[model samples]
Structures are given as C-alpha cells and as structure tokens.
Target chain A: MILPVYAQVDLTNGRWRKCTISAKLFEQYLGGKALGARLLTDLTPAGLDPLSPEAVLIVNTGPMNDTGAPSSSRFNMTFKNVLTGGIASSNCGGPFGMLLKKAGFDGLILCGKAPELSMVVVEDGKIRIEPCPQLQGLDTERIQEELPERYGKLVIGPAGENQVRFACAASGERVAGRCGAGAVMGSKNLKAIIAFGTREVVKANPEGFEAHTRKWVKQLKKHPMTGDSLPRYGSAGLVSKANASGVLPTRNFTRGRYEHYEDVSGETLADTKLLRNSGCVSCPIRCERRVKVKGKDVKGPEYETLGLFGPNLENNNLDLINELNYRCDLLGMDTISLAGTIAFAMELQEKGMGDFGLKPGQPEDLLRVVEDVACRRGPAGELAEGSKILSEKYGGADFAIHSKGLELASYEPRKSVGMGLGYATANRGGCHLNGGYLALLESVGVISMDAQTPKGKPELTVFFQNGMEAASAAGFCLFTMQAMIPGILFKFGPASFVCRAAGKAMLAARPLLSQIWKCMPWIMPINCMLVPHSKSIALATGLPMTIGKFFTVGERSYNVERLYNLREGLTRADDALPERLTKTPQEPDQPDTVVPLDQMLPVYYKVRGWDAHGVPTAKRLRHLGIPLPEEG
Target chain B: MAQVRYHGHLADLTGCRQEALEGTTVAKLLDQIKRQHGAEAYRLAKRSHIIVDRRSAGAEKGFRTPAGLDSLVEFIPVCGGG
Candidate 1:
C-alpha cells in the first residue's frame, strides 16, 4: 500500500473510495503538497472558472498522519481559489483525516458536482450523495448540530449559495475556510460532505507507531513554548506579542500597532473569554480554544481573526470580539476573511471612497456588513467579496493588503522581513499559516544562512513550506510546536523514518534519524531529509534499508511540486510578493524598522535548483520521479 | 536617571511596578535596586519589562544610557500585555 489511508468522494455518484498510493510512480516523490498539486493538474481544468462543478477538490493526507507526530493533524485541501484569482491549498484539522484512515482511506477527492442541493454522507463505508434542499439556509452551527454525532461534516454557507467570491466551507468550527472553497461547493449544489466511522486503524506495525508516538508526544510536552504558553493561551496569546511589537494590523492594514491592542490580546481573552479547550478527533494537545462571547461560547478567534477584528478595525471589547467571532462561524464565513472584508470596508469609508459602506471601530456597522456579506444583500455584500476586490473598488491597489487577491492575515511584514517574503510568496495567497516561516525567522531562525537580510528568503520559506507540507500530509496539526524550531525542522520525523528505511537497515538504525535517511534516501523527499540516527524498521515493520536511499524520496517530492506549478503557470511574476515589500520598506512602530526581502529570493531559488522563474529544471524533475512535460 | 514602569500581570506582582532610578549604567541601576530592594527584589524586577522613555529598555541597555540625576528614562514594566 502506497498511501496508507485516503478517501475519494464523487458527489455525482454518491460514492467513496480509498487507496494506498505510496507505491505509485509518483509515490517516490510522495504526494505531499507537491504531489497533491500534481494530482490536481491531472484533474482540475486550466483557467476554468473556479466555482464550477467541474473543479475538483483534492485533500492530501501523508503517511505520518495519526502517527503521533507533533502537529500531525494538518491536512491540505487544494482547489482553484476564486478569492485569490489563483490556486490555493487550504489546511484544516478535525476528525475527518483520522476517521477516513480508520475506515481504510488515504485521502478524499470530491469530483462531479451534485445534480441538485445535496449532502454526501459517508458512514460505515456506505456512501450516499443526494439532494438536501433543507440545508439551503442553514449555517455551520446548524449543520454541525445536525451532522451525525460521530461524523465530521464539511459544509458551505449561504454566502457560497449567493456565489460571493469570498465564501468558504467550514467543518465544525474548523474551516478549510480560505480561497472560496465553500463557494465552489455552492456552485456544485453540494451543501455538505459528512463522514462517519467506528473502525480502528489497524497498524501494520503497532510497535513502531507506539515508539514514535511516545517519543514525539514527550518532546512536544517538553517544548517550552508549546507546553507552557500555547495550551494555556492558544494562538490568541500572540495578540499580545504582535501588538507589543507594534506590528499588529490596525485600521485596515494602514499601520502597525494598535492603541487598544493590549485589551484584545490572547492573554486577555484567555483570562476573560476562554471558556474551554477543544481539539480535532485524535489530537492529544487540545489547542483549539473555545471562548465565551455574548454569553454563548464558540470555537475561537485565532491570531489572524484577532488581528482582523481587534487591531485592524480598533475594536477591543472582548464581548464584541466574542460576538463577532460567533457571527463568522454561524454566518458560515471565515473569521480571517470576514475580518479583512470588514477592515477593507472601514478603510474605504474612512478615506471617503464614496463611503463604500462601513466605518472603522463600529462593531454594529461591522455586524451589519457581516450579515450583508454572508447573504449577499447589497453594496456591502458586493464589497465583501474579499479584501482585494474591495480594495480595488476603493481606488487603492498599492495600500491594499493582499497577495494575488487573497487578503493578508494579521502579520505586519514591516515587523519581520522573512515573514514579508513568506506572505508575498505563499502558495495559498497571503497566508501566514501556509509557510509560517516568520516564526522560525525571528526566534528559531533557520536558514541561518541569513535572517537579518532577505538574502535567502525564498529558500528559507520553501524549505519550511516543503517540510510543513510533509507534516500536514500526515494530517497533523502545526501547533505541535508553538514555533517552528530549527532542531525539529532538520531532525527526525517518524514518517520520514519509516519511509526511508528498508526492513533490515531500519532495524540497525532503530530510532536514529541519520541511519534511516542514508538507508532509504530514495523513498523520502531528497531536498532536505532527516532520519533517525539509528533504528531498525525490520524489527518493527520487517522492512530494512540504509539511509542514503531515504533522503531522495522527500527531496524529489519537493521539486515535483515546483515542476507542477511550472506546468500550471506559476512563474516569476507569481513568485513575487506584494507591492508594499517591493517598493516601500516596511516601517514598524519601533525604530530600526526595515523590510529586507530585496536580498532574499534569489539565494532561495538557487538552493532548490529552480531557475529565476521558480521552475525546477528537467534534471531536477528526472531525479525526483516527476515526469517532465511531453514535447508536443 | 531612568524610569522603570510595571505592566500587565507583572505590575500586580510588584508593590510599585514603575519607578525611576539614578545611575550611569544598567549595572549601577541594578546595583542600586539590589541595595534598596535587596537582591531578591532586584532579581524579580529583572524578569519584567523595563521601559526607557517609551521604547523597550533592557536591563543591559537601560543602565548604559548617560548617567545623571535627571529622569530621562522611563523604566516601565507595568503595562506589558503582550
């Protein structure tokens, strides 16, 4: 079996299929983010309107999923993003990844639009896709309540039905919420996809799983930031960290730092509003915080959401923040996107851009806009299409905080140069979570190659992107480490362990990363592979190999993704960041503020063997098991 | 001279979180605090925020500023909410 567990759903046929793709030709490259993009290339239409039924959604799960890797629950869902006007890979976590695997599937691919309003229900291996007109007006809260108690449901809201370009799909309170995926579902007339199962995932080698799980879980608990600050405060804690640095997004990305930022920080929220802790299905670290707002507790207001509503618009009332958070979840909108939409409106209104219909610091007016956006009611609704669309209408493009049409999250690039590069070049459009290299750039500071200068940003960001992609492929949460530490970044990931080692060689390495990488370099991605210094896979899985063969698999997969994007036309232009970084040096509220991306991207591409266009060459592709484009 | 201010939960911990100290160097200021508040208090104070004027002033940097009897630095650790 190549891919351990994944599900394929055909909305038209109401069927579910599972397979292991680890042994597929591209299996050597491994379908991590790179392979997932390739798979979409195999299916998704080029230049097609993203919201059409023909557009396919590919959710990629990696081999290490549910194997107890730190933050191992993150899964990537790729689709044409109408909001960004480009491709996007949205990540989310809930029970769906583990359940599908338990039920014997590697990943889920939804194809062929439903004939009418319908919801596909997968229970006990039985698949049923049919029309459900009853779901038309329902929001995520309603859908979450109605879905089977033991199942995970993915559904879109009314904004999607209205074909609002910025609409999203939410699973429970966790949203694959960016890039208008919900809008795509709406276009397909597929209201929801509910998956259920009770079967246990039978491990091929339970001993290996247990050993890997214990080692990682212990390390995660010992991680200073993850163990102490994170679980207690959640990403909400950054509310204070960012604001204190004068790098918080306020007044529609107009400036960094908010006068009232301290009031809405994560610590304040945890002290006042945090009611409970929630998590995805099998995750031991319950990092998802449920906060009480307006008397009703809801999922969360993560860092981006806090930035969007708190500093971006100058709203500091935790009560209002709570209510706003609830509104986004129930309205079936993404908090990050919804917050940006409102912030954009605030900018237009403040600037007298024909009063584009909202005011800064007015929560009630913001709420009205939220309603309008979700239901596509009027001018406000149209303006709410997404931040980029809203910004262009207001006669401002340069000041508009978005990449490729997707609104930028809360990070102020002026505060950190590496993050500036990451935001500019994120595969999913202005998302910090996607690359999240800034976390490393500041504290852990990998690619020590250079941190103060943008000399090697592209390389740094790409390495993180590929490594993170590998982790997420295993369907793990990125929160395993509060910040991405260089040690873990270059160290042993158990999935890399098993993937690298041949039976006998793995036995000798027995938990040592170096041995695994040398023995099975051919099986893992080669660009940057880390293996156990010593460990025997044969003793556990009966498979053994030396380390040299393992590193190639991972490195090969990294290059394949670049080649795939090359096929889809993600060129030099696409590889660039926003105008803000390119022209004006970002100045923070503090002194010595200077954005440094001007020096980073070149060194980055060189390290990956990609030409200036960000395309991996023919030689790189041949090495990774990725087939080059056929000469016509 | 430097002014130190208390902030957030840390402010509540100190009896008077914000204050001004006279010294030519951070080490001198810290030494003065050691003599006045005792080593235990000075040790605890080091763990918190110390603002000079309005910008962040570390213990090392706060004491290094030109020493004088005037309070040109605002040593703050009181409002740190981040």
Candidate 2:
C-alpha cells in the first residue's frame, strides 16, 4: 500500500509542494483528524489567531477513503478553532475526500492569504490556484453550481466571507459544520476547492479486504439501529426517544419536555415533508432525509436543528425547520451554533437584558435574522460572534449554553448527566460525537442506563470517546459504530429486563473495562467481527491493527488534540458546562436532575490518567507513545 | 382512567395518537391496548419507551409502575442518535 501524500499549498505565492508521510507516522497517527492534529502541532505555534492568514487548514482523508469501505467517503478538516481558540477538527461525508485521494493526495495543507478571491483546483495530481472574484458573496449552492460538475467541491459562502465565528465549509449538501473551519478558509481568501482524478486506491490484502467489507456491509444492513431506525427516520429518529427520556432541549433548555414535541418530531417529518432518504457514498445506512423547501428539494434538519429551532425556541413548525436547515447550509453557517446563538439572544430579550429583534416562537424575524447573521448585517450580526461573545457583551453567562466558547448540541444534558460530562470534557468544545455521545446509551439507544448517576460514567465516557475518535480517524461514519452494540440487544428493546440488566452489567464492569483500556494493545490481539474497523485497517494498510491497537490510536488521537489545546493555553477550567446545566435542575422538584459535573469531572480525570488539574500526566503520554510537551 | 399517548409507528399500529384507557398500572395499560388494538400492537407498545407523568417508566418499575388518574402515559418508539 502507498503511504499517504499531502499537498502543501501556499496560497500567497500560488505554489504547492507534495510531501509523503513516513510509514512510522502513517502507522502512528493514521489519517484524517489524527494526521491533521500531528501536522498542525508541528506547523503551528501557540497563541496564533485562528482567523489569520498564518492559520493552517488541513483537509484530510483516511486510509479507508475511496477504498470501497462502507461510509468511507467521509473526510476531516482540522484548524485552529475560531470559536474556542483551541484545536478544532470537523468531519463531513461527501465526494471531496474520495476525489482528493483519487487526485493523488491524502490531504491538503493550506496556508498564507491569497492575493485575491481564489479557488484551488486539483485535477489528476496537478494543482493550481485560480482567481474567482466573480463567485464572491454567492451562497454555497450557487458557488458549487458555477464550478465544473465533475469536480468534487468544497466551498464557503457569505458567512465565511464575512468571517462569522461559527461559519462552516460546505461539500455539496454535507458540511464540516462545527468549529469555524470556513472562517479559516475565508481568512486565506479561498472561495472553493475542487478535485477530480481517476487513480484507484490500492489495498495490501485486496481479496481479504473485499470479503471483510462484504461481511461488514451485511452486518450493518442486518442491524436494527443502522438498517431500520436510521435509514427510515434519519438522525431525526432520536427526536421522540430524546423527548420521551426528558433530554430534549425545550425553551432554550429551561425545560426538558416540550408540550408540542409531536408536531416537530421525526415521524411527523417523515410522514408529511420527506421526499426521500439519501446518504453519503458507499454507505448502506442512508440516514439523510430529503425534503422540499420553497418548491425545491433540499436536505432536511437533523435532530439538533429540529430540537434547537423547534421546542428550544418554542416553535412547532417543522416546515420552518426544513427551510432554516436549507438556508443555513446555503449560507455556509452551522445550524447548531446558529440556532443555539439565536435561542440565547431570545432569552436575553426575555430577561430585558438586550433585544436583537428576536423572540421565542416569533417566526416573523427568524428568516431575516438568519440572513442578517450570514451577511453580518445590523443588530443580528452581533449574533455572528456566537452565544459566548453575546453573553460577554450582555449578561446571563449562567444561561449561555456553551462550553469552551462552542455551543452545545440540542441534547439537554441536565437529565442525561453522562452526556453533560461528555459535552464539558469534549476536546472540540460541546460536540456530542466528540464527547462520546453517551446519550445513545443513557437515553436514546437500546440501553436504559441510569442517566442521572455519575457512578460509572467517567470510564464509559473515556471508552466511547476513544472508540469514536479512532472510528472517525479511520474514515468510517460514526453511525457504523452502532453495530458494536449487538443487534440482539436492540431486539430485546429498552423496556426489556434483559436490556436493563445489560445496562447495569456495563456499569458494573467499569473497573474491568478501565483496566483493559489501560493495558497494552497486545492483550487483545485477535480481530473480532463485532468491530470491523481494526480488521479493515489491518487489511488495507497492512498495519498490525487489533481492537486494542485501534482504541490506542483513538486514545493517541484524543491526547494529541488535548496536547494541542493545552499548548494554546486551555486549562482545566475550560472543561466545563454552563451554570444552567450544572447548577439548575430541569425539573424543579427533581433536585438530582441537574448534571453532577463536579462529581463526574474528578472521576473523569482520574480515568483518563490525568492529574486533579486535568492535565495529562507524563506517564500517560509516554504510554500512548506521545511526546510530552516542553511545558510538561 | 389515564390518558395514554402513542408516538411514531406505534400510533399507526394502535390506530390513534391518544385515548383514555382504564388501567392503574403499566401492565394493565398494555393489557388494555391488547384488547383494544390487537396482540401485535400490544407487543410493539410493550417494547416502546414508556413515559408516565413525563418521567421514563424504565427509570422506575417498568410495567409494574403505577398509573393513577390524571397520569399521562406516553409510549415512544425506540430510535438511534443524531
């Protein structure tokens, strides 16, 4: 197998250089976020502004990308986070990653500012920086439409151009939607990136890889969560379950239960608005929902957008959510941050703190405010700074729903305490997937784990965070990780005694799991069918991959990002949820409903082999094969 | 009598979104649904996430959990993450 090659593009000089990664580095960091993190650490200095021309943006693909692996079309963009001023990595599923690999590059490292509005084009391994001043101020869709159809496109819109702090980069309808990668692109005056090539990705054990992938695809198809729930209802399927479990954010997270939840639910959308179901390339679990917006077909809202824009804002119109989702994507903005920021602004108006012509359940100004945010126009443009900045400018820091400057996803973690812990400790601010998405086990998935208890949450969070980080770095969709939970468990259902018993058993086995995680990778050398990721990597790259090694890579990846964040001056205090989640209970009568973040944080640090200060110890770093930073 | 609500496919199976049911406990509620809708609807409803008075029945005593008058028993279909 060929080692990964990265193209270093100097936008200012309009020159590029190809650098092949060493086998040692490839085996250690793998690709995607892990590789990007390692590269960023080496190339960037501490305290550099994220929205400066000196900021580095790495668009990367993993070994599995374009290799016919299920959900292998996913790619990652890593840069200095504009929202948090920490290490930022965002993943997206689209044709860009696949075509980039085909164009003979595993990644693109962009630096320096372009002399003018520009587009980077790579065709059959030839790279060029072409000025495209005419594409200025266009929405993401219009920019893509202007580009050649055959080239896989990654473009930014007006929000990115305006340097909205929560801006995102668009790849077709999919997005690298969190941590403001688009602002970094716009800082470099990059309007778009297009790649096209026909090179085939070669695997070390092609036949073995093919057979394993076939079986993996079959298992994914047979699994209840991947096959039925996701494909049928998309990620929005979690709406009813989250609401039923009291984790749905309502009225800007002041309450967990929404009175009119049924009106904005996944079932309602599927029944009323859905045109069809779609997905990323090579993915059997087609979880994308297609719906009509203003007589044109577009992507539907995910659970985050639906919950945050619906009940969180006291709105029950599902059609409005569809329009907002389409509008946000077109304008190159993240729906989670945008909705979260809007909700914060509405609450500020309610408190008579500051009015930005926004209110809960008021639809008259919703579309206009959204457009103004993207264009950075008038009072709504203040919202472009996001909730953290708004809270600083005004008051109500206690109710500002963000951690480390990045806004939280729609899961009202006051009820799902483990998810709250994940949100607080997640490397990339308040990302659910990065924080382990424990809500899947605690409230939404087959397991009905004790949501309020912090008893065994730390260990479980570490295990999940590591697993997901590795899966993402390997270029598989996070949805595939659902198969790790046996399909038989889903058959039992959440109400079954057996299912409840399984949840308890997992918590009970925390010590054993922790020990296993800390032990050497050689402890579990065998490849298991339950987790196809390790075997897939072993076959594709001929690397000595195992379940234990796969997790270690995840652990290494997470630690690398944490180290980068630390280098940027992030401290233990940065790992925190707002007072609304940590101090206030969702149900006033239920004092224990609040996320016991204090109780969980110490345990979480201990489980992660970090000191009480939450700084990773030298022993842990050495064990993970990461070099201790100079400060350490 | 408790107001029992069904969500998603469960509502389609039971042929109603909500109704007043004669039951003092969750087990009795399932039996009532069985008599009203059919055995398949009863089975599906049994597997659902039951929320009584806005709290998960799974967090309580499951089918044996009490459902008094003015209780709102909601059966929500199980699904995966966002």
Candidate 2 C-alpha lDDT tens digits along A129-156 = 9999999999999999999999999999
- Which residue pairs show collisions in model 2? none
Chain B TM (all candidates): 0.54, 0.97
Across A1-632, the per-residue lDDT of candidate 1 in tens digits comes to 33344567777766677654554533343444545766676666466667766778776555555544445555566777777655666766755655554445556677877878998776676667868887788887787787677776777778777777767777767777777777777887888777667755444567865675566566556553455445666667665545544457777666667878768876577666778877775555666789776566678777777888888878887777777777877776777777876766666666777465665546767778788888888777776577677666666666667776777777776655667777766666777756445643342211111223444355446555544554444344555423334234222211122212321232233234322322335444222113331122212222332333333444554554444445555576665555654565445433335555556666555655667666766766665556776631
In angstroms, how far off is A307's CA in candidate 1? 1.2
Give DockQ for candidates 1 onward, in order: 0.12, 0.66
TM-score of each: 0.82, 0.98
